[model samples]
Target: MKGFESEMIQRLRTSDGWKFFGVLPQANRGLAVTWWVLLLLRGILPALFAIVIGRLVGAVQRGQDVVGPLALVGAVYLPLQILAPLHRAIGANLGSQTAAWLYDRLVLACVRPPGMGHLENPKLTNDLTMARDFDLGISGPPMSISMDFIASGLVEMIVGLASAAILVGYAWWAPLLLAGGWLATHWLLRESAVWRDRNTEEVRDAQRHADYAYRLAVEPFAAKELRLFGLADWTVDRFRSMRSRLVELRFQATKLRERPVLWSLLIVLIANIVVLGSMASAAADGSLALDRLVTYASAAVTTGMIAFGGLSWALDCSAAPVAAVLRLKEAMEPAGALVLGRQPADGLPAREIRFRNLTFTYPGTDQPVLEGFDLTIPAGTSLAIVGQNGAGKTTLAKLLCRLYDPQSGGIEIDGVDLRTIDLDAWRSRVTAVFQDFIRFELPLRDNVAPGGAPDDFIQSALADAGAAGLADLDTVLARGYEGGTDLSGGQWQRVALARALCAVRLGAGLVLLDEPTAQLDVRGEAEIFERILAATRQTTTILISHRFSTVRHADRICVLEAGRVVELGTHDALMAAGGRYHTMFVLQASRFGTEDTEEEGVNYDVLT
Candidate 1:
């Protein structure tokens, strides 16, 4: 019994209904107030209705003029008739607005963490996925389902009390009998709710899989792969299998719920027979008038419907989302995590940036990607990182950009520890064009100046990135926009490059390019790199690429092997040492020579 009581208390405390109401006013104050007023009116309407019915019936039996009571009933009924539809419409609009507000908050919360650790956690990812599913306009946390439940429950209690008062005039035990049955029914419903909450986890997991499969089959990015790989039927079958499992679990839960519903119905039936029989007997004995019997009966029935239908249904529907919101809040930040510092990283690195004894590993992994890695990059000079796949080249760049902090050791900018600097301030001074850069389906100008740079800056950035011709086109970059045109892979790369350049033009001091020319042809790649180097001559640059041709142009080159720097020097010095960098460069040069020889009908292998 203590366990059950504890569970119930916890459930009530964690319920989204009240929490949602608490945040609703802050989300939209006027709408929340209006919603509350409408709820109050709705809550008391049933009792008011019972009173009007009793007055009208009593007046008729007493042979008094019934016009006043009948007119009052019409006035009450007319407004309720209008208010019901208006209430639904306003609730829907307010729910939509609140959903948008909640969604924005949820997104900001997910994005606010300084490191990528939370985003990568599988459990947190699942929670975020479930939270997103609950964020729909009608189904989301912003809705007043909980408030509605409170109001409806209040109405049920008020109506039940009024009915009990009317029954007390007949016999003092009459109210107790009715109240006992209502309490029993409410307990049964609460038990069902407890069972449903217990089983919701399994249902949510199935739903996540089903939603993922559906997206895989239909989303635009997956459409091409699905068709090419003939995975249409496979994806549909997977979706159907997961969806069927979800439905089966829900159906079983529904069956469990029906047991309590059946018990409630049986209790209601027995109570009705007993109440009506006593009233009829009293009416015949001249102890009760016919009008009073009618009023008491009406109130009794209304109280039962509000308790069983309104409160029970609200509890059943809102259990999951409320729990989801609570869990998300708890899991948003891991325990003992580093707090983001507020000390400003105002100026650019005046001397140099140093990576000292850096050792780091990805979350949920045993092996470190960078182990005791150390390097120094002079300010306002180009440094290129070259490595074979999985050698932690990109990881090094990510460390420098503060995307992930090292497990041990740290970075320093001009002698100050990176951890002590304000994260936003440090990021403001950096710009990067990654290999998998975003292709935002926006206007050309908007793409270059997402933070809104001037027209002259946008044009100059475009010219530097070799995309000046795109400026002449009046069409937007994506198809959904008015007069828009789709861009080729190479064109999109240039747009991304321009975005990075524009960031630099807007005061960013350091630019990191991670294979930005991977989409372009060999000659195009060389030309783009040349232009980038020329445009950012004064800016500090960190370039990560597989192409030795580009690495040779940088002031210094570092070859990473197994997360440790194996070689570091100027291009000519590295080439002279005949080390890993030299060997890799010779291999690439031979491959290019072989391709040239093939075009000329010569056997390069024989010549070698």
Candidate 2:
């Protein structure tokens, strides 16, 4: 019995359900204090009402005035009814405040780090999903609704204990026997009453599937594809199937067992019969006073409130997110942290940039994407990198932006190691337009110059990307807003280029363009490449593309094969050598004619 008591105490201390109590004070101290004070008053009101009713009965029996006893009943009952709504209103405000606080901490945990690896890590996915979507009422009720249920349930438990304490005035053993039987229900039916297993990976996976299917049905991003594929009914079926699986898993974890339910019923029934029978016998024999019997009988009924109930479920749903948010706050920081450097990066790369003996692999992969690679690029020149798919073309741009550090070797800007420069300072000196560039749902001016620039400068940059006539400066880029218009794929590409150009105008020295013109046609790509080259003449520019026709115009062309530089020279020089670069260029050029070219087991049709 002692060991059991110790274990129960330990579980209570470590339980996630109680963590929200600590969060209440942190969310708002004054509100938290007031909430506790009201709970105390509300919890003991039932016991006080029982005592006052006994006095009123005795006053009428003795033929005395009952006004004082009647007034006392009103005093206890009035506050009991009034405090509930007032407490609920306060709890609603606290719930909203707590949600905002959690989000603020969650955002900082994700974005405060300088590296992107943590966002891509698979291990953190479950916690991230729970913390991100908890307030949306996907897995359970929203926090505001849960808070009200939690308050009511807690008050019920407190009322039971207070009433049981009042029973001690009649017989010490009476309170112990009644309280023990009701409290035992929590232990016997613990699994069925609590949803503590909701954070398990199996449950989290089920939730993710259900949420994804729901999103596919409701979100606008997948609306076109669903209708085009005749999948409206299919999507609904999938959502229902996934939601059914989720419910099955949760029920399996929390289902009630027959043995435990039977045991609780037997114990509670035996205790109630013994206590009420003893009281009736004593009153009949005139051993117990009428007023005392009345008070004890009422107290015995109220003590049933301590049984296993809704508080367990409501507390589990509400407190799990609080614990998840706090866990993420501690875990995400070290997971995504990067080493810092204090060196100034102003006016860097005046001479050249070099990659020496570099070897790198992605975070969770074994195969190296860039192995023993070596490259050198003189400042103020345009170099085009051409490679087959998965030959590390885009990886090069990510490295240049310092999104991830190499496991071996290093990249040098001029003569300084890139890692030795301040991360923010180095980023300010570089600009990029990735293949999957962000198209913010904002005004054209904000899209072009996200960091803010003068009107004339933004206009000049827009003209350089052939985007000056696309839309007015203040027009929003998304179709969802009134008076806003969406752009065509080609037009959006030009706006992305204009954004890079704006960054360059703000004193960026290095420019990385990763498939920047992939959306444009051949003629449009050729036209845009000319503008890119002319506008970025004074910066060290790198371009990653599959188009040999466009790359041939660069100051120098590089051919990467199997994560190594196989050929590097001017377009005419590499063609003269008749090596890998020469063969690829000729094969791609051959496809311009009427027939598809197939040579050396390679089909130019698939390549194009």
Candidate 3:
């Protein structure tokens, strides 16, 4: 006991060390008060009943009076017994509720958080995972400990003192013996808590193993691949190995905990044996009456409850970091405060959208994905960006839509720094649909209205996106769910298009489309390109595609490679120059529609 206490005192310095002590006070404050009030009945009434039993036996032996004492004990015992479960039940409900509140806060902190890119940080990710599981497992233990610790410790102390007081008549060492036993239990609890803290990571690892094994037992996505590739054995083996390693670590910690636990148990056993013998001797010697002897025995026996409860509290106090992690989340999240609403007025229209030596690299990335690239797109005009993989084609569209800010240089919308403007209002003015788009398992209306546009507005946008057939969303979407069906690739593409168009109709000034028809069939692709061309008439458009045929509808073409614009002009002008655009155009034209390369420039009078 002295050794363990010394170790804790030594460790009470660092942040982790501080938390162990700090959490003790924080957790105990109000809960300790409530627990103390509740635990009064657990020990007090039990001792009183034992006294009554002793009196009843004395009355039988002595032929005096026991009824008053027995009746008085019953009056207290019945109410205490009734209230025990009620208190426990209340703690149980509180445990579950606290867990739920923490879980909500944790998930919201991740999903709806400021610093949107924090998950990329390894430290934060590990903490988030720890906090999530903490909510799942920590609630019951701590709540039980808080309530029971006060109840059991108080009662046991009273009982142990009273019994020792009785045994004081026989030997002076009796009180010391009982105190040693009770204190030994507290020592064991302290040792167990220490090991639990030391092996916190190990417990998490074990749970991960169990969780991975459980996922293998269910989860639809893994089913096909697991069976087809015959990876089930490998997965099962992985799960087994992980589980075994975790169990081994925990077992090691548990082994370290054994000596203290054994010592406490041994102490209790010795105390009981000594207590029984001494009381018997006293009764035989007529130093105590038989009824009083029975009452003392009963009271001594009930001391175990107090000891058990106190032990539980001590051990649980060690691992309360699990709860602290949850509390951190509840405190760290912004709570939708400091969230400024949309800019009160509309933004200035984009004039010459300029990238003045703009440089950008993704979060945590090693190198710049875009470097010192300068370009301009005129207002009320369409620009087609063409490039091979990793040539920064899609990145341009992302930048144009302000999904990320440039790292070193700046982007100016009509010469206004995008960073200076309200981001919410800026986003509202632009819309985008990327190649890797979300396929929502929702009704057709919801699919088209992912931005939550009005119903009539969604219908109008769907018509514009060549999705009039899916406008009566409820029946069409419900049919798919009922029949275990989903929209075909072409059908889903149209739905996404509808969503984009809906955003456009909601007053988006710029619409960025990255590989808009990549999943569409040839006919669907043609139809989609025509609708996109029509869309450009209403909004300035930036198109990214590998298919050169799609650029015929674009008013201008810009060839990009390694994040720099190498060529810029109308389709005909670029083709006449016989550059990368010309070669790619001829290649795609040969594959799709007839390729036309001989031209000075596109006729300016087509739309006019």
Q: Which candidate ranks first by TM-score, i.e. highest? A: 2
Give model 1's TM-score versus the native structure. Answer: 0.84
Global lDDT of model 3: 0.64
Per-residue alpha-carbon lDDT of candidate 1 for residues 1-608, written as tens digits (9 for 90 to 100)? 99999999887666655565566676688887887777657656666777788889899888999999999899778776676566666666666576567667667666766666767666665567766766442232434444355445555565565566656666677667777777677666655455454235676777778788877877798999888999889998998998788778766665545355788879877887798788878889988777777777776666564345334445444445545655665566552135476778766677898999999988867899999989999999999998878889888777777888888989989988888888888889899999889877777888888779888899999999889987443457888887888899889999999999998888888899998877776667777888988888888899988777677789999999999999999999998999988887777667655546322322112111
Among all windows of ten consecutive residues in candidate 3, which has the lowest summed lDDT?
A: 599-608
lDDT agreement with native, every candidate: 0.74, 0.85, 0.64
396 in model 1: Cα distance from truth in Å? 2.8
Best by lDDT: 2
Q: Give candidate 2 regions above 4 Å deviation.
A: 1-14, 190-194, 258-260, 308-310, 582-592, 595-608
Error of 1 at 361 (Å): 3.8
**Ranked by TM-score, top first:** 2, 1, 3
Q: Let me know the TM-score candidate 2 reaches against the reference structure.
A: 0.92
Model 3 bad stretches (over 4 Å): 1-40, 43-48, 55-64, 130-176, 182-190, 195-217, 257-292, 305-307, 310-349, 356-375, 383-407, 434-442, 450-454, 475-486, 514-518, 544-608
lDDT of 3 by residue, 434-541 (tens): 887777767777788765778888887777777787535663353446643377666777778888888878888888888877777555666677877786585788
Per-candidate TM vs. native? 0.84, 0.92, 0.73
